[model samples]
Target: MNRPTTLREAIEAADSILIGAGAGLSAADGDHHSGPVFDARFADFRDQRGITDAYSGGFYPFPTSEERWAFWSRMISLLRYEAGPGQVYADLLGLVSERDYFIITTNVDHRFQTSGFDKEHLFYTQGDYGLLQCSVPCHDATYDNEKWVRQAVASQEGMRIPSELIPQCPRCGEEMTTNLRVDARFVQDAGWAAAAGRYEDFLERTCVDRVLYLELGVGMNTPSIIKFPFWRRVYDNPEATYACVALDASAPAEIADRSLLIRGDIAEALASARG
Candidate 1:
């Protein structure tokens, strides 16, 4: 059988699926952090400060908190709030929507949830773009930032947000930052902990069965969170199958016997598999 059909059959036959996603999957959906999209949206920053992409801009040292929030607010609105469902994510959901499936993604874009995947069935190990927490993380709490982001995007002037619109930690009056896991200060609030628990419970229950550890677009930036564990699970469980789909996909020689590697566009592979 062909590769796509092989993948489809594996998905159909597996008792459960654990999906590990990374940036490539989102990129296939046109959610790019750099390139033409970034150039167009952040032209001012690029021309004035050599800040080219959203990722770099996040780390840029703006002169003041107002300017910093301005950059972040624009990024949050563009990537988090305004972004729409991706067809690749929808295709993935369709492939295993009826099966016992759970997602563990390092992606912070919230694409899976917006694409109609069950929120409870997902573990976003990295923090989300739609959330804010204390910069010092004085407390373990995350606040939703949709309203603030929208307002900031609408009201900002000359690459600066009004000082009043900058988010402040409710508990300690310190500056608030995106809930993304840039450092040790990233908060793991009640919701994050609950999702982590669910992921662990799912792993405990499914690792023993005919599980398909389907990894997509994952890279080497942070392997421990999803890639390494998925490899270990498949190695330990004889009934498990490991599949990876990416533009440059490969498998460790140890798991090669039970692994399926699809090296190509993630969206195309998903579409062909679904067919």
Candidate 2:
């Protein structure tokens, strides 16, 4: 495999590329760290000990389902619609949008799409912060979450957040909420279904072609979705060339000969890649 010193070289060697993004991408792009409430709550959780962001938080400690919904809805409200300007993400998208590419991200914040990426070209592996779905997995429908999130902020009462942010289903009117893919029961409403179909279709169309895989700011904590499977795919495909922009500069040992491992910040590396 020939190593690329510039963006042109990277594109010349491969037919198309598939991008995988993670939290670090948004962080590097200057989005605020979760939220002010996040810092306070994280400290409090640690102060109590033995308690973490519960995986099955919808069913976690709370006298009633309403309280549980309150905690989770507040969390969802903070992370999705609310974030910093997306100039970094938009710039990155401009560089790649011209090429035959598809993006998959674990970021629930709609940054990629908000930055002008076509909605059909992206697959948000994690549920979107901007959308709400039925908590009971009733049917495939989604609603914009902005109104409720705004309501939550407007009705703010101290650090606990406003109760109105907690969403309820429109159909059954029972506990409707963000479609964040945190566990086994996450619902994929209409938009999710369409996005997922595009993702699968992208993979299908590209299956017969040689692909360039670009991984940005992904790490091992969620190895299966972002990091490790990427390494495995590149390793298994002899025609593929891999590149990653990560804080840790390490290549899959098995594919080190065919990969470009850049140890740097994502926004900086994106600049380098574009140049």
User: Which candidate wins on TM-score?
Assistant: 1
lDDT of 2 at 175: 77
> Candidate 2 residues 1-275, lDDT tens each?
46665444665677888888987888888764444556564444334433344333433556544444445545556555555446668668767788899898988778887688888889888887778788786877778877766666556443344454567777787777567776766877677778889888887787656787888878776769867766877787787777887878578679888787778778777776566
* Model 1 alpha-carbon drift over 4 Å, by segment: 1-5
- lDDT, model 1: 0.89
User: Number of backbone collisions per candidate, in order?
Assistant: 0, 2
Error of 2 at 99 (Å): 0.7
Candidates' C-alpha lDDT: 0.89, 0.70
Candidate 2 regions exceeding 4 Å error are: 5-8, 34-78, 159-166
In the predicted model 2, the residue pairs found to clash are: 168-176, 169-176
Write the residue-wise lDDT of candidate 1 on 102-200 in tens digits.
999999999998999999999999999999999997999999999999899888998889989989989899989889998999999999999999999
